[model samples]
Target chain A: MKKGIFSGLIAVTAIMLIGVIMLTSSANIKNSGSENIAQGIWEIKKEWNNARYLLDKATTDALADSANTGPCTFALDAAKVQHYYMDTIAHIPGCTQAFTVAATAQAGNYQATGTITCSKKISNDFSIKKFEKPAVFTKTVSVQKDMPAAGDCTVIITDAQSGLVEISRVV
Target chain B: MYGENKTGKGFVFSTDAALGIIVVLIAAASMTMLYAPDSSWQKIFQSTSRSMADSAVVGFYMNKVPADMGLETEIPAAVKQGYCGRIYDYNADNGAPGIQSAPMDRNYCGGI
Candidate 1:
């Protein structure tokens, strides 16, 4: 009877140890996965923010350059502005891929609107874990433009205010 | 029979002692794992990252006037105080320009 009890005790102890090990291992794995997900999401968010900043800078630069040449010209070359904006984004690290930007400028006001589409990839040590689907964000800016009432003169564009209007993520 | 009985008694005592030790050890280890520091670190990191995104959005809206306009370029005082991290331009020697690091404690912000 004593021998039987000893054997039973050993068996139970072994089972308990195994259970504990398994539980702790699983918990650690889960914690690590959550950390990775958080890191990935953070990276994506930072990238989006950087992209928006670049777009704003590009737009401002284009406006400034145009103002330097012509003081009261309300007509902005949408294609040229878009080209400069995309070029700025391309120069940013991790944003080497092609991005599309559509821009429109109002005839009278100092407002320009743009839509940006960009892609990002999130990878892990084992594999490419997540691929951010191309997302679209709209940008709108109001520049302080000094237009003449009735004369062919240069437009004074300054004191720009810009921000993202909307952002939609497919995935 | 008497000798066999003595050995059996000894065996039972040793087994009981071993079981007691195992149980104590398992309990201690389980408690330690439950209170591990990694979880806290993970929470801090998550919060810092999220705060960074929030700061970016807020900064964009706040800094409407261009810097050349000589307007106050600083963020709102309420936002700065509310955030646990700082929002400085990412113009480090080797850092990317036009990007801002997320809000985090001083140590975490240093790394960024």
Candidate 2:
């Protein structure tokens, strides 16, 4: 009788151990998914900020000369976009999809807003919850027309979903 | 006396062994779930976000130079012609000379 009872207890313990392993694996999978989402948001923020820089250069060129009729405008060439998009791929570890960015500039008194739409291509499981989200960034710049010196600038990055991460100044 | 106690002690020992195995398994799984690889997703994301923000910071600064220079509207006649692409019709040929390459970054159409 004792021998039979001991064997039964051992079998039950084996089953319980397997169950614990299964539960742990499931949690790990979920964690991986959340990490992907966070990384996606960060990647988009970086691209949008690059677009903002181009807009700033255009603004500076516009104000540099006093006699021009319209603001100085610069078009985003294919090379610029391709260079930035490709460079980021190396930085995002385990990232499979390439990102695309489009910008529409809105110039104000001393500030110019660039509305950027950045998309990432990833597998269904790892893809972000929503594709379209606004990533807003602001830059403060002081421009001097006579001086060809690189002026002081600061950028603020914020997203509707991810919140503020960091403020980087021009290096 | 030995025979009687053998059965009771054996039963208790087997039960204790079963319970201990279950507890250890749970603890092992919990540790694996809670702690494994040390990866900082926040830091990775922050770095990317910083790159984007930095671009805007520089752009804003560079924009002021053009706005201050009054070059916002003052394109050199040669630059304007080059922007037009085709040769400028100096003769009373074309009524309005259309600018070919307009500024894409100039958000405010009205000079900054």
Candidate number of the best DockQ = 1
True-structure Cα RMSD, model 1: 10.5
Chain B TM per candidate, please?
0.32, 0.26
lDDT of 2 by residue, B37-104 (tens): 32555445444434433433343346543334233233345431211000011111111212111223
How much is the lDDT of residue A97 in candidate 1?
Answer: 29
TM-score, candidate 2, is 0.34
Give the lDDT of residue A112 in candidate 1: 45
lDDT of 1 by residue, B12-69 (tens): 4454556666776787577657645356655565565466545444554464222322
lDDT of 2 at A56: 31
The numbered model that scores best in TM-score is 1
**Which stretch of 10 consecutive residues in model 2 chain A shows the poorest summed lDDT?**
A63-72
